[model samples]
Target: MTTFYAGLLSPCALACAVALALTGTAHADDNADKNTHTLTPVVVTATMQDSPLIVVTDPKQPRQPVPASDGADFLKSIPGFSTIRKGGSNGDPLLRGMSGSRLNILVDGGMIAGGCPSRMDPPTAYIAPQLYDRVTLIKGPETVLYGPGNSAGVVLFDRNFERYTQPTLSGDASLLFGSAGRSDQNLDLRAGDSTGYIGISTNHTHSQDYKDGDGNRVHSQYDRWNADATIGWTPSDQTRIELTVGKGNGDAAYAFSRMDGVQFLRESTALKWTQEHLTTHWEKLEVQAYTNYADHVMDNYTLRTPDPASMMPMAMAADVDRRTSGGRATGTWRWGDALELQAGVDGSVSVHTHRAGGPPGSMMGYYKDQPRMRDARMQDIGIFAETRWSFAQSQRLVTGVRVDRVQTRGYTLEDMAGMEHMESMSGVDAMAMMPAQTAADRGDTLPSGFVRYESDLSRSPTTFYAGMGHVERFPDYWELFGQHVEGTLDSFRALQPERTTQWDIGMQYHGDRVKAWVSAYAGVVNDFILMHYPMTSMGVDYASNVQARIAGGEAGANYDFTSHWKADVTVSYAWGENLTENRPLPQMPPFEARWGLTYEATQWSIGALWRLATAQHRVADDEGNIVGQDLGPSAGFGVFSFNGAYRIDRRFTLSAGIDNLFNKTYAEHVNAAAASLAGYVNTTRVNEPGRTLWIKLDAKL
Candidate 1:
């Protein structure tokens, strides 16, 4: 396996180059105590507003953007995020404009499911952003207490690991070098005292094949690894107990399908406990539980090469695994001048298994398979409630409700030519001539609601809110085992269950250097699972389900021009309609803008960013739902990035950047589709990568 990943990257790059050359002379009285620890003005975790981080509170915040190389490039800098690219680091995240399973991503709150179906391990590529520390995002469906179906909203990548006071110990480490031959490394550690604490983290990323913007190459190579550990216990001061363990693996190479991506493994374990009793009658109470595991494998000779009409051609292999477990408990109540209450109950269970055989070459190689299909289970149960009322104190009222019960079961112990060779080995030939039934079951009971209204216009610093939400979703697992034609199997058996009714409004303003925010939304969906791709045969691409209607809004602004300079701007737009072929609404996401400028002193800082996009003619011209080619419209581009950071003291810091500075080439209008190699043809638009530079280092003791 590439020499065991080059023997773990040659001693972690020779121990981070001998700790950056013996910490490169840092200590002039620790740079005067790191010049009195500066650089703490960057807040705005998706609005709860508190200015500083260069303003720009909404429009899906992302002002001085262009610093993300993953997590869909930092959620495409907010504003109803958007991504579907199929190159350079598993992209996939589309909000407000929805995408797969309707958003709802969490880490440190569990739930990570992505077993390709052409998704390619997206769950933010198994996270690993230096072990998280905040990345909240809540767009459409506002709030639903982290659990439940999210109509494109809710993305939390939190990680706190409290920092104790006594017997303390800190940690930090990072290294990154980029451009076509990118590289990454990270480490984090923590030890505690004052009652409890423990932590550990690890990460490594690699890249090789990259060349676009006309340079060609493309087939994007990749390698990944992740490790995690956590232990916590706090006996007093509002109790806490936690235990977590994690594992990850990776491989990739797919310039657009025909099988590649050898294996991707993931394992997770979690245990949690929390308590906060402030007496005075039901002040607080909370609890949680979790478990997860996933194992996946794909082959066509591990990362490309053999393609004799792939089904693993001269050599093929396949495997899929799944295991999920969950739990949750909660309670809260407070009354001192109105109401406040919260209640919770959660549940989850998932199990799946699949297997395959190999051989066609290597002298008739070896073969032994059984598990061609049949083994699935799903379950979910929920009960939730939320309330907040203060009908006076500047008007306030929030409400919530939830109820869930979902179930699914399947069993058919291999037969029918191993379920028609596992549906022709994933090319999914309309479910390889169905009729191999043996067992099946299903059940549902879903409901959700929301209401909100807030005010703070009184003292005029501006703050306003309005909300209404309703969601009823069910039918996941890639909409029931990766959509197998027949009009999504009659829209999954006469569809029904996917109701959304939304209306949100927002406003925020802060003074003392200017900060701003604006949010707007409008939704109405009923049985809207929209995904239609007709015109079949030879060009194969079938997916069905219709009935849709969508709208959008986003805006942002910021200005400081002083405190060492600052400026920001943002904008986003979305639209959809397809009331049964009425038109427009095939992977939305267009009309975008972002601007930035920054410069700080006291340590060092510099920044610049600009991005603009527009041009997409909304398409879907049948071809069995065309999987590639015939992407009618697309044109519009702009890109620029630059960053610098310094602060080599109180621990250490240094960051550098350069991204597509002038490389400009672009493509992304919900990209995906680019393989058909025979001189490679098949472009469903997705090519962007050229001109790159990077450097990052951070250390703390």
Candidate 2:
């Protein structure tokens, strides 16, 4: 081991190594074929990268620290990703220290926007990771093929449906039981013939409040479920059509909010068609349309008793809903064997509405009866083209460009008193405090593009890549209409669009017994929209554009010491500077590292993972995005975990794990501050769950 690796070997990590060694390593069969690859039953570290810029992972695979419940949970397994912890679930996902619309999250090529103005329900909250076939992440602003303004990156949750030649029925099911009353059930089934196929998927998960290391209960509990169906027609080898429909509902209790999420309802549908080999040069053409809806409700009295000493010392409820519908059509063409091009046009429209009833008790029963009023509307239309050219035998050039016309309209009426009340309740002035009765509609034309070069080394099994990308992003609903300027009421007209120019470079190495990759990025952001929260009751909240600088890198390596034993390590770090403020950007994640060791045989596997994080001292207090603000400097901590999986037969498998093996209590730096709720202890930040034991059973048919 290198000296740097020796320096990182803490006592907890040593203990993990000792424990794993004492348990004995798996025995490899000498009669088995040496070239036949075996999948690790338990994934302990970061998933492997498919390329220098792309990461692909199986969402159905069993991973350490228990399987994920939401999209944010699943993304955390990848380096350069973190979650803004908001209780147990429904937390916002951050990539390379950026949140909100900067990170474009797409489900099966469709976008879904959350309804809550407070961000109680983010886009990933409605996603159940296990239901998807695969998750793909494109790091940095390296591509414009998807939607616009993906300055941070793009995460895609997709499913694949292959044509069946004969009649077939296939399915997979899983059941889980864990400590703290956690349980989950999932089923995915498909029946198909040569002409058509039908597929159904369902999932339900529930968890009770869990205690921290000190046996203190953290108000983090949730119940969620989802059901989806798909119908596909494969008339020929070159033609395919698919239709999908899905819906889900859930409720969650939060330790970082005064109100609890009482209801989270989602409805979605999509239609897709594709034709391949249309002409000599035309490779394929595809068209897709999708619509998604979210209905979210938050209340103070539904999950727990109202805190009498808080700002809102009475029963209150706010219901908000958003409907987003969009469509895209793209054509792919290839020229001989040297070049390929893809072009597409896409558009979307979103409408947001809300209704609320409040006070001590009078509005409790009538809240749902009140009619909802439209609050805001947003629209986008974009055209994009991407191309790849194989100029040399070992070198390739890739480039893309996109242009989008974005528009927004606000419906909030001028209400000074209501604004003051909202400030007292949420510590932020709302859009109702507009200077005019209603803000005029605003629109902007933005452009984004990127260029990259990739090459394979002559003698080494390594690929080197470098890229530069630029993106112009318009202000979203929360930045434009949801917040006010410090002393100005015309925030809608004051916030300017943000522009980012970034450079990303990386290299990947694939060897006979070792695999490794490293990626790094740096960017200069002009007009970076930042939100400032109130420090006291007399203070006011505001949003302003500022200059910023960001840089980060992630590296991981896997080594197979022997036929059955393997070791892996990963490290990630991100840094940001607010040039306008001349201070560190708020909510930047701290330096983190993970060490994993595993032993695998033909039928079973055992693994150990030790995660470490460095304390963050560079923070701009009270400044951040819509998800959360930095409270102050946070202390760092480490956690250790162990997992094991056994394959009983081809039809069934069992997996189990002990998370936080030492029962260490810790909180993440990029996290929401704890709120003063009625029953929960008021901590600086919401702590993670204590030691947890869980078991899972998977069956394939």
Candidate 3:
């Protein structure tokens, strides 16, 4: 398996091929014909519309081979997505070499960000994929319909409520068990009649520390639970209104950090109204409003015993919270079925605050005596419009434009006991705050848009398209308030907005025996955000802006050699350079590819998957995104896995898989270094899990 993964495709060739694999997934054909009903482990990638690539998948379906514990783990199955591993769960996701706010992640049209300045919990960490109906990824600065930034891309976890003409009850439930004390249970139940409906979903997962391929334990354990409900009313055939409420809480242990998350609380609410088949030229209308909150608590003693001799030799804890609220209104129009238009206005506002205490023993519980310090406030309002015009029999033009008002403010900083920001670790203000005794506010007017052209070949089953886009991104909380910039910043006003211009193109081909696609992009960026770690030997990782250039793409193909036999191949690659310093941009990963072979039968099926990565030589010491920095070049590695599934009647299915068949000890290049724990003093990339077996049972009604 290693020989096949490492030798079938050359590093340089693989990168080039993936750049042309425009759709980035072998399931493009399946996505095009959505009416078909089939079961697969998961659908990681796909293409939609005429511009860019949007990999869409039904979250209710059980993917084969691997089942992820969180959003980031699931996304890594797709090309162009990687994660910074701190442990088994809560790994921060990176896209096309970009992390943090540049990706524009949204949950049910609302934003909820964790408060750890070090990014211990990114938006993806809080997501439970099974709770949502669909996951959509829009690669690069492809479109303006979602929101701002998107230099890396846009990720959307959404839910769809379908109305019924008669009373009906439906949903799915599943149970999963795996190695390292892994276990999970999930249920999604919904019931309703023609006029109204109600739906509910709940999930629970728990695991203990897992051993690596070498039989050495790693501090990667977690416990979590989530529940949500939706109520909808269908007053008429063309009108519907829905309301949703959700709550979740969890705790986790990490191997590389001094603190563990003792509490992760999430609360959310949303309301949406839709009216279709409107009068005149109006096609539809949608209006929505939502609010999301995150309350997190981290401590050194809650999940692990204190290391008396370590740097953090005592127990410490911190409490932080953030709240975000947003609203959107949109209208759809059509002209003779040849042209379609969508226009809308969207806005969001967020507030962040924190309090910390501890050291010799433990901090005051409940942050009762500590003073609440309001540190960050952000707001955005935008107007956008997009159109699709079929100007010719086999050609179409797609374009969109958006304008936004962005603002950010930082207030007085003081922890419990009246400690100042620069004098304590409250903000992880290790480097120091922007010296703001009084609140400081900054705002900007930003513009972004994209245009795409597509053509369908009449003589062949194929399609082709190209697009170009430009986007201006406002600096996020971590970039502006999380760190300092010496004499140039303190009100942190020196940071500039990120500007990007890129070109994208791709094509897809479908045939009875052959299915394939290629996608590629190249772009230039101005004032790109770069996190410089340990600036001035003060242990501060601060944000800096510099010019840069980037290019890369993904490609894949599948062939059915026989009625019951099939082969699939996929590759992904990315390249970047710091124009100002002429060095390779930090944290860029090496070539990666996946190969799979499978056989299908009447009641059962089996498959094998091989994942490979090339050794990376490019390095920019101590430079990367907010989550982590590049340690150095990493060695290449590969792993082989196998899976099988059987239908146990009409309503139930059983599936099992063995990962890392050889128990090969390997680590990913884009990962955190080993912690300096007492017994585990070595500092190398954290090894992946050893050979393990997993089984899952899926049931639906």
Per-candidate TM-scores read: 0.31, 0.91, 0.89
Q: List the residue pairs that clash in candidate 1.
A: 42-53, 60-79, 533-625, 534-624, 535-624, 541-624
**Model 3 global lDDT (CA atoms, 0 to 1):** 0.78
Model 1, 623-678: lDDT tens digits are 11122323557787888777777765555567777766787667777677676654
Give the poorly placed runs of model 3, Cα more than 4 Å off: 1-52, 359-369, 413-436, 483-491, 535-539, 679-681
lDDT of 2: 0.85
lDDT of 2 at 356: 87
Q: Candidate 3's residue-wise lDDT over 158-210, tens digit each? A: 87788888998777777778998887777677889889899877677778887
- Best lDDT among the predictions, by candidate number: 2
Better of 1 and 3 by TM-score: 3
For each candidate, what is the lDDT? 0.66, 0.85, 0.78
Name the TM-score of candidate 3.
0.89
- Give per-residue CA lDDT, model 2, range 1-701, as digits (tens): 23322322232333343233222211222334556554546654567677978999988877877754688988988988899888878888999899999999999999999988778999999999988899999988888888988999999999889889999877766778898898877767788988989987767788989888888899988988777889999999899999998888889998988899988898899999999999999999999999999999999887888878999888899999999999999999999879999999999999999988863446455577789999789999999999999999989999999999999887774424345455455323444343445545889999999999999999999999999999999998778656334323366777899999999999999999999999999999999999998798887788889999999999999999999999999999999999998999998999999999999998799899999999999999979888889989988899999989987655557899999999998889999999987667778988888999999877666
Candidate 1 vs. true structure, TM-score? 0.31
Query: Candidate 3 deviates by what RMSD?
Result: 10.1
